[model samples]
Target: MANSIFIPLHAVPSGLNEIIDLIAFGFSDVGRSVPNVYSAKSSDADENWKDNFVFVEDVGSGERCWVSFFETTPDVTGNKEWTWLAGVTARWSWDFAGVVAYALCSYADSIVYNDSGVLTGQEEYSAKDLKGILSRD
Candidate 1:
């Protein structure tokens, strides 16, 4: 199973592409759909044109902690919003996922979200909040 986080972006410095540099982490494009997601239309919703899917990894030593950049088709979903569905597999990868989200929050003007692990609402984590979680030893 994988733990997931939702990064609802407001305005990235150079659109979605900026995220590649902002995170400063190692990742590779395992695969991606054709036709480019940015040019997708709302009327094309029925086709469900989901976008890029990348795999995150450690900078060196090739430590693999699979992270998927699940970008859903916004127009099809009926909301003009974008989110980084950073899904982390395995327990060890959870922290890596947090680090990725933390870096994103620091550079971007938005918050990230995930399960609170409680019975109630989701946890809307800030860069500071994720730092606290990641710093725990």
Candidate 2:
């Protein structure tokens, strides 16, 4: 899986709202009601992937920003179940890989935000900074 970039809904074309809503609903149960809020996509040839735009309001400035997410999967274990080794291990490994990869990418973005809220002037990310983002140490 690749890094999931955060995108604002406003940046999306007028035709893709339904796909965003669908992804949002998949992420949270509350989003289910928003299904069909918009019309169909721009064209039948558009590949609507599991990508979505998020409008995040700045806690201090109240400015809204957008981000996009990709390649997300549902976790049904509820955090307390033991592993079932009876099934194919390859599938389990792939699932875990997606989870870990997403987590690492998110951590990097968080560090980017914390170190430079808007990342206004940073031209390069140092190796040290990269590790710091990975572990937040």
Candidate 3:
């Protein structure tokens, strides 16, 4: 079984394409190359229009991870919200997993959200925090 974690993202300011690119760049910055990355969106009319997902494969070890983003109804504050579901397969080692987690946290921290037509705070996540989250299961 693969070890995985789901991160809830609130008020994501960027679109799916931009997020995907950001994650890819994050991985590259850490020297953990991802040779293949792919994305797809659901075409079924019955499904929510926000349904989209991405898959990333490590260049050297062939380990794989995936991310899925979906929008949720606004809260009482009426701010746009979303969820970021991400995971890595068991094929990855603890060190590699930590590296990936760091990359993810870095990407999350880089996101700047717009609130009430103004760019406000940035997303927050620490690599150490993410590593602790990923170490379970």
Model 2 bad stretches (over 4 Å): 1-49, 70-120, 126-137
The C-alpha local distance difference test score for the whole of candidate 1 amounts to 0.46
RMSD of each: 9.7, 16.0, 9.9
TM-score of structure candidate 1: 0.51
Which prediction has the highest TM-score against the true structure?
1
Residue-wise lDDT of candidate 2 within 1-137, one digit each (tens)?
Answer: 22222211211223345434433332233111221222223453454423433332323333332333343222421122211100101112222222222222232332121222222234233324433333321
Residue pairs in candidate 1 whose N, alpha carbon or C atoms collide under 3 angstroms:
none
**What residue pairs are clashing in model 2?**
5-68, 6-67, 6-68, 7-66, 7-67, 7-68, 8-66, 8-67
lDDT tens readout by residue for model 1, 1-137? 54566555433333334444555531211111111112222342232223434344555434334334445555522336554344433344565555666665666555666663411234677666666666533
lDDT of candidate 3 at residue 26, scale 0 to 100: 55
TM-score of model 2 vs. true structure = 0.23
What are the TM-scores, per candidate, against the unseen true structure? 0.51, 0.23, 0.51
Where does model 3 exceed 4 Å of error?
11-16, 42-50, 71-100, 110-125, 128-137
* Winner on TM-score (1 vs 2): 1
The regions of model 1 sitting more than 4 angstroms off are: 11-17, 25-50, 59-91, 116-122, 135-137
